[model samples]
Target: MSSFDLTEDQQDCLQELINVAMGQASDQLARYLDTFVYLKVPSIEQVKSEHLFETLNQDLKATAVVSQGFFGYEGIRGEALLMYQPQDSHRLADLLGYEADELTFDEQIIDLSSILTTTFLNVFASQIDNQMSYSAPRLLSANQGTISEHLNQQSFNWDLALKVRISYQVTDYSFNCDMVLLIPEEAINNIKAVIDRILEDF
Candidate 1:
């Protein structure tokens, strides 16, 4: 039996896998917006549940909302989240050719948002899964308030967190999206075990 802590190589692999996933996410966004999308590598930061708001505030000055859930293979599960400043949502909707103010919580927008979120999760998860040789990914959406709501939670198991941020410029409008990864503490041990097995075999 091996200790749960991840080896240095495992950490590097996780980061590399996340980078690939984020790159795929950015490409998908570019295709959807029909314009180049500027992206930054996801970062891992230690944050206190109480200070979540402050942390989110540092990256964005407006009301920050988040949508989160877990997705991945049978055992090698991965968590996912989408967060952004509330104001950015309006610009993002507009980039998709939607009038933010005109659109209400109608099923159409809700359904569309679900679809968009699913696509983003799928693309990102698929890339990471490929790199790790994991099973197909699964996606879940939070029915909470907004993006900020879930992210601000006092506690959520995320032993490994990766955040991919995007800033888009379409015409005069600016769009922002943050793709976050959250893995439960248990999964950290599982992932480390998987890495150890691989290392032993080689």
Candidate 2:
């Protein structure tokens, strides 16, 4: 039971919208990994920038990171961060027959990440966009140290942002992926508007 600037209806809409986005991600993952992929009922949260790692530390420590962003028609909107356990990501890479070195700069690797980003966010943004018409999202990320430092150095407006946690599970495997969805504080009102729209649709 946590308090948020968003109303209960907003939260529910966010959940439903994420469900659709997760489905899109799973579809892309299944095709890309050449294995069946499924997702759990994703969990959402709102937290400060400094507490990000602490909030998701337990779920993130074991995973290799794969993240991107979600933009809407209005412009740069929110971000999407995905983390897969090392073993699982390694298995996925191997399943795709990618060598260790190939994972970083290979054409397939680049295309895969891009495709995942485009597909996942396009659907996600669209769902939320239907309500508030968010601007298009641009994906961003780097290695663990870089990502951590980048966020740490930035000045954040806490009042306007929210953190959405989306967890994924493979239908035929024991692997799990946790996705962190974040929107800046200034965009919080827009996000809530999208959530409200979703709730109305329901």
Candidate 3:
């Protein structure tokens, strides 16, 4: 893997941390919605940042998007994105406690993405034992091409990114969304080191 100086064992250990982070995200959603939230098993992948949209296109349509950039005191930094198709929008709207047709579809997407991204950042920052802060998330045009296209357009040519994707559904309703966390390759080594330290402590 292009995980900087991380070893195979360290990679496995790093995933354990991600599992915990996912759980935290799940719990937050369940409590906020006051319903059971089922998070599918998450998978980790190492790929060029440019390949993100193409790779995820098979499973994600990304008709809507919310993107946020984050950074921490220890120098670990990157962005988090939440994307879903129009068909999946109503489900997400309901999960946010809105009637399917109540809010402007774009409004619902913004609300949903903001909630998920904040929860993710909290758990992730806590796990890595760093003080990470986020910039105000800017809503983007859904008409924009694939998510990868947006990233490329931004001129952020990342060589590699570690992607952890989890699909979640609200058990009480037919609502589900895919959450993808992208950590740059440069941050992976620092993240691995942090997770390793946590494992050693326990």
Candidate 4:
């Protein structure tokens, strides 16, 4: 097994926790949007920092990115990133009961991003029984860079990433959202320690 690789049993337990968080987020979104929200079988990967784009997600792009960092005395620290199509900002605004005019577009994107990120992020931390706190979410537009690039710029040398993707369909339009938790190379041991505890509880 590689440094970032998880045993089959660990992967199973992690996927279950991820599924719960994703399902809860979907339910909240369904009620918020008044539309059906669907989740596919979630996945977790131990991807190298360099191969982030190719090995992890082929559709990764330079678009809307919202992220928050989590940490506490519990030694749990990681970043949550959400990426979506910039074009969907307008539709999202309308869904949230606002028009996406020039003046409101930025605020609309930020608000939508915050709602989606916080909902599931909190769930992930709680399900792990780790008292993690999150910093205010940060948003990057298309001009800033791809999400991977942004992570690199943040001086984050993530050796592995745990990615979960969920989709939402509203009538004729369909949207795909990618959410990931990136772990630094040095933090891998610390994280797997937590995962071990989670597995023991299972």
lDDT by residue (91-164, candidate 4, tens digit) is 76667666557436556666766776677667777787766677887776543556566555564344556544
Query: What TM value does model 2 have?
Result: 0.68
Clashing pairs in 3: none
Any residue pairs clashing in model 1, and if so which? 65-147, 65-148, 66-147, 66-148
| lDDT score at residue 87, model 1, on the 0-100 scale | 53
Best by lDDT: 3
Candidate No. with top TM-score: 3
As for candidate 4, its clashing pairs are none
Per-residue CA lDDT of model 2 for 92-175, tens digit only, reads 445555775665533333344455556666677666554223233323433344345435666665643577776656655465
Estimated TM-score for each candidate? 0.62, 0.68, 0.82, 0.79
Candidate 1 vs 4: which has more lDDT: 4
**lDDT digits (tens) for residues 72-154 of candidate 3:** 86667777677766665556666788777788777777787777777867886788777778877766667356666555567
- At residue 167, give the lDDT of candidate 1: 32
Question: Residue 27 CA error for candidate 1 (Å)?
Answer: 1.5
Worst 10 residues of 3 by lDDT: 1-10
Order the numbered candidates by TM-score, best leading. Answer: 3, 4, 2, 1
Candidate 4 ranges with C-alpha deviation above 4 Å: 55-57, 60-62, 99-103, 143-158, 161-173
Candidate 2 contains a number of clashing pairs equal to 13
Cα error of candidate 3 at position 70, Å: 1.9
